[model samples]
Target: MRVEQQPGFVLHARPYRETSLLVECLTRDHGRIGVVARGVRNERARLQRAQLEPFQRLELDLLLKGELATLRGAEPSGAVMRLTGDAGLAGLYLNELVVRLTGRQDPNPDLFAHYERTLRRMAGGEPLAWTLRRFERDMLDALGYALQLDIDANSGEPLDPSIRYVYDPESGASPGRPGDPHGLRGADLLALAEDRSPDVAGLSSLRRMMRQVIAFHLGGGELRAWRVLR
Candidate 1:
């Protein structure tokens, strides 16, 4: 399959053989893919080294068949982009999530859009916490694992903002479970569910809850980027 000038971002890259690179990319229409860019590392190569790094929007020319594709060329499709400090870690964390959860060639246009927007917001110095939460929610929705927020897992009624609750990853929110380590207030959960502004108090709780949810779905796979933040 030959593709030309397709828009994508390198999620990760590493040295392959002497002068080539193994690149993992997330594309607008092709989801996640792996590619071999031959001889790009040589001194006389025409491909821009700047465009091969992760988290930048790139237009890639590729020829793919089974597992890996041959990268014909790549160049930045937009302005230069960078993510540093906490934002960088958060971006990497999001990348890890996408790589782990998605199958090759499984297109999710919504996930791609959310990822681009989150990176833009983070690059612009917006707070990482809210941006991450929003992305996680959108990602879960797109992946068909969205958190159950509108109704209680047990009572089968609309959630009440006044009550305390515990979230079950496979299930949803239920009235507090005894000795439950992760507990959230009904109001905060509702705010997060509604995509409204969450106060500082609610932010921490929501983060923990989302982490638990993500971990459960991932079968406890560790995200090194998340550990760096903690």
Candidate 2:
């Protein structure tokens, strides 16, 4: 299939053969895809190679045949996102999540939009913890693992903010044993569920909870980006 000027972002790229690159991209309509960028590593293709970096929106021309699409051309489509320090690491984490969780050619417009918005927000200096947690929630939902936040898994009742709950990765939240230090506050869980502004403590709670959920869904393998961001 031939695609023209497909809007996308490079999620990862590695050297292929002598002068080519194997690029993974997330596109608006095509989800995650692998493409072969032939000869982009050569000195003459420096300009084209530069356009394949992460966090920059691009218009890609592709020729899809077998397993890999041929990257016919690429051009920046918007202002390049220049994130630094922790923000930069967060951006990388986002890319890694997309690469690992999304299936090739499975179109998810909402996920794509969430990813773009999160990157933009991170680049604009939004609080990292909140921004990343929101994206993680959206990403999980898009992938069909929506968090069960409103009800207690054990009792099947709405959450009580004053109570503490133990979250089971597959079963959701249930009331915790009294004074269990590891239990997360129902208030913080509710805040995350409602997308309300969470205080520092709430943000911390949500972060730990999200990490557990994401890691569980990833089948126990920790994300390299998460390790780096720590």
- TM-score: which candidate is best? 2
Let me know the TM-score candidate 1 reaches against the reference structure: 0.95
What overall lDDT goes with each candidate model?
Answer: 0.86, 0.89
Please provide TM-scores, in order, for all candidate models, with all chains considered together. 0.95, 0.96
Q: Best-fitting candidate, measured by lDDT? A: 2
Residue 98 error, candidate 2, Å: 1.1
Tell me the TM-score of model 2.
0.96
Off by over 4 Å in 1: 177-180
Count backbone clashes in candidate 2. Answer: 0
**Span of ten consecutive residues with least summed lDDT in model 2:** 43-52
How many clashing pairs in candidate 1? 0
